[model samples]
Target: MCGIVGAVAQRNIVPILLEGLKRLEYRGYDSCGVAVNNGGLKRARSVSRVAELERQVDDSGFAGNTGIAHTRWATHGVPATNNAHPHFSARDGEQRIGLVHNGIIENYEEIRTELKALGYVFESQTDTEAIAHLVNHMYDGDLLSTVQKAVKRLHGAFAIAVFAKDEPQRIVGARLGCPLIVGLCDNENFLASDAMALAGSTDQIIYLEEGDVVDVRLDGVRIYDRDDQPVERRVQTVQAYSGAIELGPYRHYMQKEIFEQPRAISDTLEGVLGFAPDLFGPKAQDVFADIDSVLILACGTSYYSGMTAKYWLESLANLPTSVEIASEYRYRKPAVNPKALVVVISQSGETADTLAALKYAKELGHRHSLSICNVGTSAMVRETELSYLTRAGAEIGVASTKAFTTQLTALFLLTATLAKMRGKLDAEAEAFYLKSLRHLPTALQSVLALEPHIIAWSEAFARKENALFLGRGLHYPIALEGALKLKEISYIHAEAYPAGELKHGPLALVTEEMPVVTVAPNDTLIEKLKSNMQEVRARGGQLYVFADGDSQMSSSEGIHVIRLPEHYGLLSPILHVVPLQLLAYHTALARGTDVDKPRNLAKSVTVE
Candidate 1:
């Protein structure tokens, strides 16, 4: 995935474009570039961070009233200056059109061959360059119509913004599968892949639908549908978190989000007097009643959350639950059940694979759908019939922290609601669960206090190249998440297994050099997990255990233990995950790796 931002303002838009790119840096940071319609087309490109590109713009004194910018996460080509966005289409040795794109062009090879036949020379090896050349070929003095025609010939997902040297003060944008928003301001209009990029500049935004093309000028904006018919879209006022985006008193966004878990869980649980079906939506009761099973569709960290929910939904609600990786769900021929509830979990809600899976489930006659998402304006929220908005503000870190915990909080509430609805939980049991949830914020605070201990462990872990995580029963998915976090941020090779499976195969990989991180909650599986730990000790493996305060496990010899403040019954997973997040953050810090923007990863996965 990449980020795109465009502006049609009378004022010099160089600063605005650069600032917008900075806000969207989480989406992409491999390379960045900007192109402006100055005297002709002035441009700056960098195969580095946006801050370096900004310095280049400042050194060159580049200024333009209309411009387009992009920050890229390398897809088609390597992260190089030649492959960066704001790609140009030249004719007669002069650049005519400049474009910034956010998705893949599947049929680019065909288009590139056709363009070469037309005597157009290509510069970069990116699929996006084909779009620029095609747009240039289709131009008939109308940039908007040309973009619309060019997109028709292209295949696969895309959201693009284009500006031409011949069309001053005019910019054209189109959205097919990726997200593109129009920010409405007085006498000036802006375009960005995400609304947060235009946070302070404008609150009013128009979310473009699929196959919609927009013509933006200093005076106004005009939109057209896929069939080339004039259409109007709703403009909503979104409260962009301009202040929360700042890293105040924190080393990185991952660390800040790791510490924000308590507050994020509290905000996500706000207004929950008690669990009820309507907490999701007005139609949730009917939908939940009709569904006999739940099929959770998600990817990456969100997929781990869904895996955690599968345990709750099956054990507490007495329902069959299945978790599928969103990217693979549609590719397989799954037995469709019309009564099954399709629950899609995503932090950004714009994750391309998850969104496609949700639509695929709907296509197979699954009527009941629910979305657990952080962004209220995201496509997943708009598409699903029932939804829970996790108030885990803007997650700037490529490795998720607050979003994961908040999703657990929401899924726990969903479990309670379903259990009560199905008569599996009585009034007294419901009250006890609610009280446990109410105590969660305080419980989370105590877990955060263990950061000092986790930081200490990270020092040892940072030197290791491999790790193994162990958990049993309901906590197994959390171990997977822990391993994912370590590998994602610290670049460590990590693996997780149900504690019993250690002896089957994973135990052979255990040795003194392999640090085994165990999630030893004080549950029914505690003794079995202890046996697993003894097995590791017998094999000369070092142990790092996150145990419950009352688990009675302590640091001795090769085994190390850091007890959590409380044994939170069914809700212990939420608390145990926080320490793992802190461990990953501190480990990344010790290893001198980028914690917020890990290598070869973007915060929001908008492309498959």
Candidate 2:
């Protein structure tokens, strides 16, 4: 969960690498370092921001034609300078083979033991150091082959960018599970863990798949598969903008992203909008005709979107649908037919568990797999046979708001198309939901206007340490998402219970200090959610209710009611999620936490 970027630029590579690292800081910010070899051997490392690291390089007058850098989120040790990356191994672990790693190393213990046995003492607690030594152990001084052999001994999800002293002109990168992008420029080339890392430099990028190793030099790059066979891949055009990924005009990335929802929703609806009436050109249903069931595997907010999709697919498409948390889905044997169609939903497309679940589904003999993801060139999209891309541009916030809504929007459209195929829906029922879905952006805009109200209520939450979110039916997933967003950003101990499951165990935790959020919008499940709220209220838990504006439920004396616009059938979750997103954002902001680059958290989890 770190950001790694390397560049061989026409100009001084240090400045370009620093610019890229600054853009990619949202991925990680614990520490930053860079190593560039211009005319001679020069190394720059620092314990602070990328700017400070750049300043150190400038002060030392270190310049290089080729370089690799890392912005870190510490997982192995304290977020200190010693633990920072660009760990070099030459004479006495000084500056020999410069290495920066982005994923976890699972075999670090065993490798560390062996390295110790080989008289290699470690500098930092990072698993990456072992890799630096492993490369040294494997390098019979061949930069490319050494990296290949070094990667062969390592296991886990990792994207490593290495620069050797001998091969000052070359940078070798290897991908095990983490996402990697190699971009082309006029007389220059770049390597990043994600396409967004190089969003400013180029739009054409070649996405590296699992077990792909690339040797990048001044003018060319060669990719090799796991078995050492040379492979050729194409550069795909990526849709990205300089400002879309920039930290424009906002106090924090979470806040900037929350306000970007209106535009994000619109962007996600592009191309697919105004075409749902003629969507998929009448052959859409036939495309999914062989499907028996849809097993949606996702994690976090994407999992909640899958939950809502399950309701839509079964209710609209009349197909049996099962939504599973990607973390738990593979542990148990699932009841699915060989003809079952598995749909994996992920925003980053590199979510570790969701990607694993997709692979597990394929191993189960599912003939077809589809990925519903926002990012265009994510591992999830590349690995799946059929896929639907949600045009929700780069979602940087760790607490996913727009991506979840967009994924739901795409899945809802898919449900409608399938319903039309199964002959389950005629004109009336079909047009109603699709038209309602098209208006979701406007409805979501209406909900976005409630941000100030949610922010006001957030003041009461900044002091609370725990929160309970409750909803039933479709709203249950909304509750889960709310809880997730709150916990992810605010660091609050939040829990979501299936309203019915309150009495089972969660009710015992209710207290005056614990804020209980009830998603009680006027739906068939309102009364049920109300009963759950009463259970919490009777137990002295602070109640904060988000209900429909049209509902006559009088505002409780002490409880906060975040009034919602008139409730629509299925678009309610899409609209209701806005306030929760704002609540989490404002709450985290109030706490003065690093809301965007939370500790030990990266935007994309490329490793399982």
Pick by TM-score: which candidate is best? 1
Q: Against the true structure, candidate 2 has what lDDT?
A: 0.81
List model 1 lDDT by residue over 469-527, tens digit each: 99998899999999999999999999999999998999999999999999999999999
Clashing pairs in 1: none
List candidate 2 segments past 4 Å from native: 39-41, 92-94, 273-287
For each candidate in the order shown, give its overall lDDT on alpha carbons. Answer: 0.93, 0.81
Candidate 1 weakest lDDT stretch, 10 residues: 20-29
Q: Candidate 2 has what TM-score?
A: 0.94
Error of 2 at 576 (Å): 1.0
